[model samples]
Target: MEDQPEHSVSNEKSTAVGERQLHRGDYGAETELQRHLSTRHVTMIALGSSIGMGLWLGSGKSLASGGPVGIFLGYILAGSMVWAVSHSIGELAVLYPLPSAFVQWTGKFVSPSAAFSLGWAYWFNYILTVANEIQVTSVVMGFWTDDLPNAAWITIFWAVVTLANVFGVKVFGEIEVVGASIKFGWIIVVIFSLIVTSAGGAPGHGPIGFRYWNSDPFTHGFKGFLSVMPTCIFAMAGSENCGLVAAETRNPRRSVPRAVGSIWLRLSLFYILGAMMVTINVDPHNKDLFGQSGTNASPFVIAYREARLPALAHMMNAVILISVVTTGTIYIYSGSRNILGLAHLGMAPKQFKHADDSGRPWPGLVLSIILGGGLAYLNVKNSSADVFSWLSNMTSLFTLFGWGMICLAHIRFRHAWHAQGRSDSDLPWKSWTYPYSAWWGLIWCMVLIVVEFYLAVWPLGLPPSAKNFFSNYVSVIAIVVLYLGARTYYRGPWWIKLTDIDLDANRRFYVDTEIEKVPEKGLRGKAEKVLGFLFN
Candidate 1:
């Protein structure tokens, strides 16, 4: 890729502003992302990001905690929150498509310090996520090979992902597409089989319609449902990554809106329906089975085994492994890109701007691999998975924080648009219900954050478990300390002025006319169209 003028920063001003401003590199006129990320890749990324081992491994916990009713309602609540957040992100993405996306927008609407805190928090969250996924892959691998140490497996997996990333973004996207296809296909089969078996088509069982329900329909009650909200939110976390890639998308204006609009349907069909199938097939009260199975236990696997298809368990495990790897790879890719964006904005070291012939951020990718691998090694050395749990919980917090920032950014972006006397139609993508959707998403995120802190800090009369309490609270505390430390060093006041925010700097690279295609009529039309369909 030819290096553009906007990609280079001036060296003369580097020393004048001091290291902090120097680190906040220029928000260039152009971003160094490839347009190779097509609509299918983008959509598949969003799908794959949300549908991970979490669904397979974590769903049982959610079901056990909330029962059928809690599982259903918790997912619905979290899914709706994700939907609104996706829409809010879409609006900002259309208006100002940047690589950092929400973080950059937050900086523009809030403060540089706010952006700094939010950006690093998110980057750290993804790093921890990348580490957690590595451990998860190791755990899954150990199911087949008990001899190999998990640390060794994690190191090997990290190296493979790092190599894939170094090859280029296109290669990374392609691998993810293939990985996503396997996971998505497996889920479809599982869902179908579930429906068939529930209808009593199996030879021995007959129809098992709601049999598990009568056993313990409301097992966990309200608290159980609330308890599982963190995992549910984690599953739905990546629904908005589409907006993050808008700057690199062929037609972001059109594609992002289309992708955002589909969040509701996807969540309903993929998550809600999939969870319901598990609930119908497996009894949540079967603590004995769960205890024996542990993390290797997928309700779908259990159901398949019970239905005389024990081999399906192996297939599902393989698919889950692939899903974890894919998600881990994407997290590393995203984390590196976030670092590159930060580098470009002078928020990080300038070395991160080093891109190869394929425009891959080499330095950023290397750093992520090192960080991810190091974290994995640390977890193994500690002989405690509690660090992983704590990191995962903190990730949930940061993810919520990022979502809240997106809504706040959208609100400010709209106000700026109105202040400039631009009509809503003038924008490339418009969010329905205006400020209300944005406000609702923001409020919901704030509520989740508060609740997460509460759950982390106080037991609310639950058993006095040190592991449970610290695992929950440490993340929140760590993030606050990091944010405050960064702000203090920068000499920034707690409150940031909105006028100082640079909302429009990174938006100049977007080409609005590229994504004007209308929605296709039938299935054939939709199938025939490629990347453009994402926008439609």
Candidate 2:
């Protein structure tokens, strides 16, 4: 990744450049990351990150508030918007395939102030989230013993996940692949178990099928549905990490879309349907379903026990412990890459973008650890339940805004791409549903967020509490504050015109146009093509 002389991208050339190595990026001078993550790496990362504490722990909130049916509806609806956003970001990300996905694009496509807001907002969102995940790990471990203090467990997990991220992208990818695969397989098993247990197939139960669903499909009605949204929002928030890893991924144009395209199907089967299974098997009135009992309180675990599988429930609890740590490791890396992206935009100091010999973002990782790792210590004095509640309210809406920004920026980028006389097919991955799809995602994400906010802060409903009001709406206030602050400090135009964007800036130094088009002449080629289509 030594400096290969910088070259400008040709405007007349097509946007779809096929699979290629990434040496330079649209990010400023510090684009020395080693492109090593494969399609499986990113796909699993997308899958694994989404299946974190949200499903393992937060499902309690979704079920307790929304009940089975309401929570399922919430996930499916929110997931649809995220699905559109995935395609939107995939199309734009392949253009530059840089770290932090939609972050730097705002500067060139929208305005400098806007880009600053998106970049820092995304960075803080993940970094702080990583800290919260670590705190939850200490709480999850408490399922086994209270012998060790929360601080000790927090320190241990903080160091382990930090090293995993700093070890390099390859190491990070391998961990996620294994962790996510296990989680996926476990979900499938849990689904089967739920079906069986509900059918009176287990030892103690006698055909509980549809009993819970028929009795209490909607817990708190419409307001309850809104309450579960933050949990669903947090569950669906991590898919964008696929795009954030673009700069360090091989053949992003192919890998990113391949990963992004699968998000909806995964959510349908894993999240929405998984919750449906819990509804069929577990009683909505169960106190443990609220996640107050830590790992033991997980609906998945309780579902296993309902089937007379206590040992299996405990084992799944152990698996959840590993999944939490794995996800925390990935977010730490992702957050740092975002910081590196900011440096590339010259929005932050150059040191944050520095890379070591293995293409590890040393400075960025250190900063993430300093901030995220330090914040994890909050679990020492406060309870994990309280910390999780605060973190959830603060961050639930943040990444939704990130997705909205991606759609908005993509709308602008598409207009500019067409205005320059470029056909949609010329792009590596044109969002076929473009303009309409992006608008659909952008508008709904905003509307749902507004409605959810009102549900939380509304005077009549929900228990009156400062935590409810502040935690839920603080992110909105923070975004406005950051935008105004950036606008004042940067003092730039409100929006950059489509024609003026430096499309030529930071084009990858390497390109292989024949990546997907290579002929399948030999048997080896045919197998490779099939595998490529499956993964690439």
Candidate 3:
């Protein structure tokens, strides 16, 4: 599979864009994606992908481990790293805008083995995450009914999402937009209320100020801070999906950069400001409030409780449940697409290559649903409520691994581009601080992986309940084994041959540049451009 070439490059001429004509078969595919997704859909989808259960439930764990300062710094560091990775992906997405952006790019720019390993790794990661998200949804629902087994809710939710995807991609996009809108709305309300309450409003609690951090500035100290970095990084991990969906967006050349550029704003508003609000409003040392029985004591919830707004806590919980469901839907969609990409490339079973008349990969969607539902059921039976926690941590390792691979691939891609004498202007979106940003992301991911490995093994200051010190490392180990096995079987050396990397050579097969347009000037044109910016 690694050695197989998906397409052959020919010098025929076909298709015109405005005034320019593309070489015949510029993009590898014969069919073009319909531009059904608008800018709002794309932006919200990106936002939704990054701000799910992690921010709601996982933040408490990070705070418990690292305390306030730890959680704050971990997010800052990780957010910066993710920003770099996102930019790298954005650059590639704009240039190619293929269905399976990352996997396809890896196959073309690095080695087929690299692409195969990455595709499987990312697919497996999302599958596990979907299982985890469903489990979280069940747990949250249990707050209302403990008698109903989580597995039942898991199956129901999985079925609903499966049916949604089978209908068409547009359904998925619309659902994501609505889901994200709810979550984003809830966040805005929470943030606004927190600020208002902190400034001495509502009943009682006179100008709360930063009294929460007075006694224990750093709850767990340096050890705690180091421990929380992994989870913090996980929260910001999937923002690059904006680029992944670039192929489905209209005018990706402009849309992709706009999406990528939004990362900084999101980090500032969502991660940094959100974390700050939680830390300043809720004390990390509130042991009784955030202990084991209080697993659902998200820092956000804790803040509301502190302000004597118990009702808001319930509302937040409901919002969180919806967030989990929305996130699961997105995960399944992405996982199925990854599988479809693999099938198209001859790496996965051809059954996954089956697409409906509307271009939705029904076979892959069904497979993802069945697998996700089965995993959810098995996890419920074995681990019960703890399934989501376990799967979430395990998936974090793979997320880091995926980010690291992207950075490395971009580094190689830039080198190859320079070697081929291609200028940056020829690219749709260019990543700034070449090599530096990519290297920073790679290094941070490596560091976090090592630290996570140590935490999983030593346990050190961690709670004794944390099990299987090596479980989180399983994904990393699996990736290594696959790469080595593929390398040995292919009779290839450990080093990759850069020139042999296809890097979108097949993309020329389907890219219809004639349909693509350059932005126009004036108010009406600018308004259209602004609207176009939202889809991806």
Rate residue 115 of model 1 by lDDT: 75
In model 1, state the lDDT of residue 295: 46
Per-residue alpha-carbon lDDT of candidate 3 for residues 1-536, written as tens digits (9 for 90 to 100): 44545442111111112011011212223333456665556667776777876777777777766777778888899888988898788777777776667876766666556767888888888888777777666756655677777778877788776776776778888888778778767777887888887788756477867775666657777777876775676677678788667767766765666667767767877788888777777767665233234545567876776778889878987888778788888888788777877776656787876676776777777778878767877656654325645676678888887888888878888887777777877665687767789999999889888987877776635554434675556777888887776454433334345554445454422344534454377763564465455433
Off by over 4 Å in 1: 1-29, 203-206, 287-295, 377-388, 459-462, 465-468, 489-504, 509-535
Q: Model 2: which residue pairs collide?
A: 16-426, 16-428
Ranking of all predicted structures according to TM-score, beginning with the best and ending with the worst: 2, 1, 3
Off-target runs (Cα >4 Å) in candidate 3 are 1-35, 145-147, 204-207, 287-291, 378-385, 460-467, 493-495, 500-504, 508-536
lDDT of 1 at 214: 73
Best by TM-score: 2
Tell me the lDDT of model 2 at 190.
77
Candidate 2 minimal-lDDT segment of 10 residues: 14-23
Provide the clashing-pair count of each candidate structure.
Answer: 11, 2, 18
Off by over 4 Å in 2: 1-26, 291-296, 459-467, 508-536
Query: Could you tell me how far off, in angstroms, the CA of residue 124 lies in candidate 3 after the best superposition?
Result: 0.9
Worst 10 residues of 3 by lDDT: 13-22
- Alpha-carbon deviation at 482 in model 3, angstroms: 1.3
